[model samples]
Target: MTTKEQLTVIRRLMGFAGPYKWFFIWSVVLSATISGINVFLPWLLQTYMDRYLRTSNATIQIMWMFAGFYFGGMLVRAIMQFWQNYSSTMGAEYMLENVRRKLFSQLHAKGMRYFDQTPGGSILSRLMNDTMTFANFWALLNTLILALFAVVSSFIAMYLTDVKVALWTLILVPFLVMTIWYYQHYSSKVYRRMRERLSQLNTKLAEAITGITVIQEFRQEDRTSKRFQKTNQSYYDTRKAMIKTNTLLLSPMINLFYALGTALVLGLFGVRGLHEIVAAGVIYAFITYLNNFYSPMSNMMDSLSDFQNGMVAGSRVLRIVDDQTLAPQQHPVAGATITRGKVEFRHVTFAYDQEHPVLKDVSFVVEPGQTVALVGQTGSGKTSTINVLMRFYEFQSGEVLVDDRDIRDYPAAELRSKLGLVLQEPQLFYGDIQTNIRMYNTAISDEEVRQAARFVQADEFIERLPQGYTTPVLERGTEYSAGERQLITFARTVVTDPKILILDEATANVDTETETMIQTGLNKIQENRTTIAIAHRLSTIQNADQILVLHQGQIVERGTNDELMAQAGYYYDMIQLQNAAHKD
Candidate 1:
C-alpha cells in the first residue's frame, strides 16, 4: 500500500484510542527514554574502562563509583520499563473494549439486508478474531517506535566513539533496511490471506456446530468432516507460507548482517590497536553498540508481520464501523407516534435482488384492532410481506405507513418498540423464566412478568418447573418441549403489550394440543390490538378479519375467509388442499 493509505488506516485505528490517548503517549515517551538510557550505558562503560580502570593508580573509590553508576542506570530502566508495560497494556485493553462496543452497536443498527447477506460465522470472526488482532496493533506500534529510537540512538553513540568504524557499519544499514522492506512487502499479502482463511474456517465451524443435529440426522458427518477439512487444510497452507517467509527474511537475515558488521569492525579495531589509535575500551563499546543496532533490527523484522496483520484486521473492522447500510435507530427529529395502530402498505414493491422482485405492487390495510391473515406457499412472499411491515428490508417504490405516516420517517427503535414479533420457531434465551418473559427489560416488574405468563396460560407449565417463574432456561430452551417454548414466547409478547402484533407462522411447529393453547394465547393478545398473521394451517386463521392469499409476490385474493371462499378463488383452493391433505 501507499504511505498515504497506511497512514489513513493507522489514523482510523487510533481514533478508538480516545480513552487512553495520554497513556499511549506516555508509554511511547518512556520507551524512547529507555532506549536513550541503553545507548548511554555502553558509553559509560567505555569511559570507566579506558579513563579509570586503565590507570595503575586506580582506586577502590573509583571502582565503587563505576558500580554505582551502572546499577543506578539499571534501576531507572527497570522502573521505566514497568510503567511503560503497564500503560501500554491498559491502553490496549481499554481500546479493545471500546472497539468491541462500537462493532456490536453497528451490527445491531444494521438492517436485515446486512444479516441476510452476511454469514453469522463471518461476523463472529470479525468481532472476536479481528478485534484481537487490532489489540495487538498497539504493541506492534510500540515496538516499532522503540526500535526506531534504539537504532538512531545507537548509531549516534557509535559515531561519537569512533567515526571510521561507524562509517563502515553504516554500509550494512541499507542492506538491512532492504531486507525489512522485502519482508514487509511480501508478508502483508500472506497475512491478509491467512486472516481471510481463518474467517472462512470460523464460518465453517459455526455452521457445523449450529447444524450438528441436522448433520447427524441426515447421516452426513463424513461429508461435513470432509468439507471442514478442506477449510482447515487451506488455513494450514497459509500458516506454513507465513512461517517460511519469516524464516527467510526475519531473524536469519538479521543475524547474517550482524555477523558481517561485527567482522568488519573487529578487523578495523585490530589494525587500529597495532598503532594504539583506538583504545581497547572504545573497541569494546563499539561492539556493544553494534549488537544494540542488530537487536532492534531483529525486533523490527519480527514485529513487521504483526504490524501488517494488524493493518489487515483493522481494515476489516473499519468496514463494519463505516457501513452505511444500517437503518437509523435515532433520528435527529422524532416522527409521529402510532396511537391507533393502523397499518397500510401502498404500491409496495421489494426485491432482495432487484432482478427478482419478492413483493410486487402489493397493497393492504390492517385497520386498528383487527387481525389480517396472510396465506401463501413457500416463496410466495408471505414472510416478505411481514418483513416489509417490520421495516426489516427496504422496499423499492412503496409507502408503508403506520398511523398515516411513512414508516421510513420514524426512528427504527421507536417503531420496533411498539411492534411485537413472534417467529415460527420460538427462540428462548439463557435466563430465568421471569427474566426471559421480561427479556431483561428493567422496566418490567416480577409481578408484571408473572401476570403476562398467567394471561397466556404458560403459568401452568412454568409453575410445574422446579423454580417456577425463576426456572433457568437452557440454551435455546431445548429442555422444554416445542409447545412449552412457544407458550413462553406468547408470554414474552404479552408482557410487551405492543400496539401491533405480528405472528409469522407462529403455529407451524406446535402439536394440536400445543396449538390450541397457543391459539388461546394469541386470541387474548390480539384483543383490541392490530395484528398481522402468516399461517399455513387454513383452520387456524378462519376467524381473521381479513385474509389475503399471495402468489408469486402478488395478492391473488383478499377478503374475510367466507368472502374469499364464496368467490371460490385462490384462498378457497388453498383451504380445499389443506383439508384434503388432513383427510389423507
Candidate 2:
C-alpha cells in the first residue's frame, strides 16, 4: 500500500474507537501529568543539591524532610502512571472487540459470490490476526504521546539551564528525523511482506486441516506436509527480515544519539567550569534532562515497527468492511408479506461475477401447493436457479415474484421465514437434537420440536441415541449417521412450518436405505406445500407435476414427466443414464 493509503486505513481504524475515546483522552491527560512530574523530580533534586547539600547549613532534619518529599513525588507519579497505562489498554481492548464484531457482521452481510471467491483461511486471518496486530498498535500510540510530551518538556528544561549547550543539541534533530524517515520507509515494506506471508501460511494450514480426510484417503499427506513446510519457511524468512530491521533501526539508534547528546552537554559544562566555578547541581540537572529527552524517544522508536504492522493490518481488515459484494437488497413496502407461495421467474438472467451468466433468461412458475422438479447435468444451472429464487444472489435482469409480488418487494425476513431449504449435506451445530430441531428459536417449545421430529420420522433414530434429544453433538455432528443428520435437518426446517419448500438435491449423498428413510419424510413435508425440487436421482421425481430440463444456462425441456419421456429429449437421456448406472 502507498503511504497515503496507509494513513487512510489508520484513520478509518481510529473511527472504531469513537464510543470509548474518553478512556484514551483521560490517558493522554495522565501522560502529560506524568511528563510534568518527570520534569519536577529533576528540578527538586537540583534544588536540594544546590540549596542545602552544597551549603554548610545542611542538617539531618532537612535531609529527612527532602527524602520524604521525594518519596511522595514517586508515589503520586506511580499512581498516575498506572491509570494512564490502564486506561489506554482498556480503550484499545474495547476498540479491538468492536472492530471484530463489525467484521463478523460484514462477512455475514456479503453475498455468496464473495465467499465463493475468498478462501476461508484468508478471511480467518484478517478477522483474527490483523485485528490483534492493529489493537496492539495502541501501545505505540501511547508511546508516541509520551514521547511528544517528554521531548518538549525536557528540551525546555535544558534550554532554560544553558542556552548555548541546548542550541548545540538542536544540531542532532535533523539526523534524528532522517533516521526515523529511513526506518519508516524500510520497515513498512518489510511489515507488508510479513503480513502477506502470514496470511498465506494461514491459508495453507486451514486448507490442510479442512481437507485432512481427503488428504489421508488419497495418501497425499506427504505432498500437503511438504507444501505446508514451504509456506512456514517463507513466513520464517519474513520474520527474520522484520527482526533485522527493528534491531538496526529501533532503540540502539536512539541510544546512540542520546550518548552523543550527553557527551556534548558535559563537554560544554567542563569548558565553562575551567573559566569559573559551576555548581555540581547544574551539571547533574543537565544530564538528567538529556536522559528524560531521549528515553521516551527511544521507546517511540521501538514502537515504530508496530505502527507499520497496524497500518498494513488495518488496510486489509477495512477492505472487508468496505466490500461492495453485499447480499441482494430488497425494496420492500410496509406490510408486504407472502400470503400464498406462488413462485414465478420472468426471463431472469443471473451470474456470480456478472460477466458470464449462469442463469440466462430463465422463466418458470410453480402454482401454490404444486411440485416442480429440476432435472439437469452438473453445471447446467440447476443450483443457480435455486440460488436466485432463494435471493442468495442478485440477478442482473429479471423479475422473480412470489405470490405475484416482486421478490424484492417483500422484506428479507418475510421471505426467509416463509421459505424452507434443506441442502444435500445437512449441517448441525454443537447442540442437542432438540435444539438443532428448534434451531435455537426459543419460541419453539420441546413439544413442538418433538412434533416436528415425529413429522419427519426423525424421532425414531433420535430416541434410540443415548440421552435422546439432549445428546451433545460434536464436530459438526459426526456422531450421527447421514440419514439421522438429514432427518434432524428436516425437522429443523419443518418446525418453522414454511409456506414453500426447497429441496436442493437433498438425497444425493445417502445410501439406498437412508434415501428410502429420507424419502418417507419428504413425502410428508411436500404435502400441500409449494415445492421446488432439484432431482439427483431420476426416480425420485418421476411423479412431479412439472419437470424442467436445463442445458447450459437455459431450460431445454419443460413438461409433465410422461410428456418429457415421450419427447425423449434432455430429460429422457438423463433418466436413461441414471438407470444404466443403477443397474450396474
Candidate 3:
C-alpha cells in the first residue's frame, strides 16, 4: 500500500477506538507498569550477586526483605499484565464488532447498482478477513509499546553501570535500527501481496462452494477441482515467497547485530584494563539485559510483517465504514399518503453505468388499486423498472411519483415501508419461522401472523411442520423446499400489509400445484393494494388491468391484456410460443 493509503486506513481504525478512550488509557498505563517491572528485574539480580553475595551482613532479615520486594514487584507485574490483556483485547474485539455492524449497514444502504458491480465473495472477504486484520493491529500496538519501554529502560541502566562499556554496547544499536527499518520497508510490500493473494483464494473458495450445485449439474467437478488447485497453488507460492525473503534478508542481519555486540563487549573489557571496573556478576547481568533488548527488537522485526498485513486490511475495512450513507432528500415529502395507489413514470431514463442507459425515456402510469403486469424477455430491464420505482437506483433523468408527490422528496425508509416485495430468490435467515415472519416488526400479534400466512396460502404447509411456526429454519432456509420458502416469504410480505405489492416472478421456480396456491394467495393480497407483477409467462398475467411489453429497455407495447393480444404484438407472440411449448 502507498503511504497515503496506509495513513488513511490507520485514521479510520483509530476512529473506532473513540468509544473506548478510558479503556485505552488504562491499558497503556498498565502496559508501562509491567514494562517497568521487567526492566527492574535485571538490576535486582545484579544486586543479589554483586552486593548481597559478598557482604558480611548477610542476615536472614535482609534476604527475606529482598525476597518480599521481588515477589511484590512480580505480583504487581502480573496484575498489570492481566489488565493489559483484558483491556487491549477487549478493545480490539469491541472495535471489530462495531466495524462489522457498520459494514453490514453500509452494504445494505448502498444502491442495488453497487451490489451488481461487486461480487458476493469479495464483499464477504472484506467483512471477515479485513476486520480480522484490523484486530491484529491492536495486538501489535501493545507488543510495540512493551518492546519500546524495555529497550529504553535497559539502555539507561547499562549507561549508569559504566560509560565505556555502555558506549561499546551501543555501537550495534545503529546497525540494528537500520536493518529493522529496511526489513519493515521491504517486507510490508511482500506481506501486502500475500494478503491480496489470500483474499483471492477466499473469493475463489466461496464461489466454488456456492456454485457446487451448478458445477455438478454440468458435470464439471474435475474442471472445478483444477481451478481450485490453481488458486490454492498461487496463494501457497505468494506466502512462500514472503517467508523466503524475510528469512534471508531479515534474520541474517538480526544475527549479525547480536554477534557484533558480543565481540564489542569483550574487546572493550580488555582495552579498559579495568577487570574490577564491572564485577563478573555485573557483566553477566549486562549480557542478560542485552539478550532482553535484542529479543524484543528481533521479535518486533519478525512481527512487523503481520502488523503491516493487518494495516493493509484495516485500510480496506475503514474505507467501507467511512463511505457516505445515501442521504435523504433535503426536501422530504410532507404528510404523503397513497390513498389511491397511483404511480407515474415520466420520461424516466436510468443506467447502472452512465455510458449504458438501460431505460431510456420510459413513460407509464397505473390507476388507483390497479394491477399492472410488466412483460419482458430476459435482460429487457423489467427488474430495472421496479428498481427505479422503489428508488433502489437513482435515475439520470425523469420523475417517478407515487400519488401526487415525487419519490425523491420522500425519506427512503418511510417510502420503502409502504412497499412489500416478494423477489424470485427468497432469502430466509437462521431463526424460527415466527421470527422470520415478524422480521423487524415485533409488536405484530399472532392473529395477524396467522392471517397473513393464510392470505398467502402458507398457513397450510406451516401448520404441517412438526413445530409449526416455532420450527427452526437453518441458514438460507435450506430446511424447506423452494416452494415452501417462497410461501413463507409471501406470508412475511402480507403480514406487513404494505400499500404497494411487487411480485417479481415470485412463482417462477415452483411447480404447477404450488403456483396455483401462490396465485390464489396473491389474488387475496392484491384486492385492495396496488400490484405490480413481472412474469415471463404471459398466461400468468393475462387478467392484469394493464400489461406492458418491454423490449431492449423500452416499453414498445402496452394496453389491456385483450387489447395487446388483439394487436398480435410481443406479448401475443410470447404467449403463443409458451402455449406451443407446453403442448409439445
Instruction: Tell me the tens digit of each residue's lDDT in model 1 across 195-230.
Output: 999999999999999899999999999999999999
Best by lDDT: 2
Q: Against the true structure, candidate 2 has what lDDT?
A: 0.90
Tens digit of lDDT per residue, candidate 3, span 43-159? 786787788776655578878887888898888888888888898888878878877887887888776666666667768878998788778787777677777877777777778
Output the lDDT of residue 131, model 2.
95
Residue-level error in angstroms, candidate 1, position 375:
0.8
Which lDDT values do the candidates have, in the order given? 0.88, 0.90, 0.80
lDDT (C-alpha) at residue 52 in model 2: 85
TM-score of 2: 0.98
Runs in model 3 lying further than 4 Å from the true structure: 2-5, 47-57, 248-256, 274-277, 322-331
Candidates 1 and 2 compared by TM-score, better number = 2
Question: Candidate 2 — which pairs collide?
Answer: none
Off by over 4 Å in 2: 1-3
Please give the lDDT score at residue 30 for candidate 3: 81
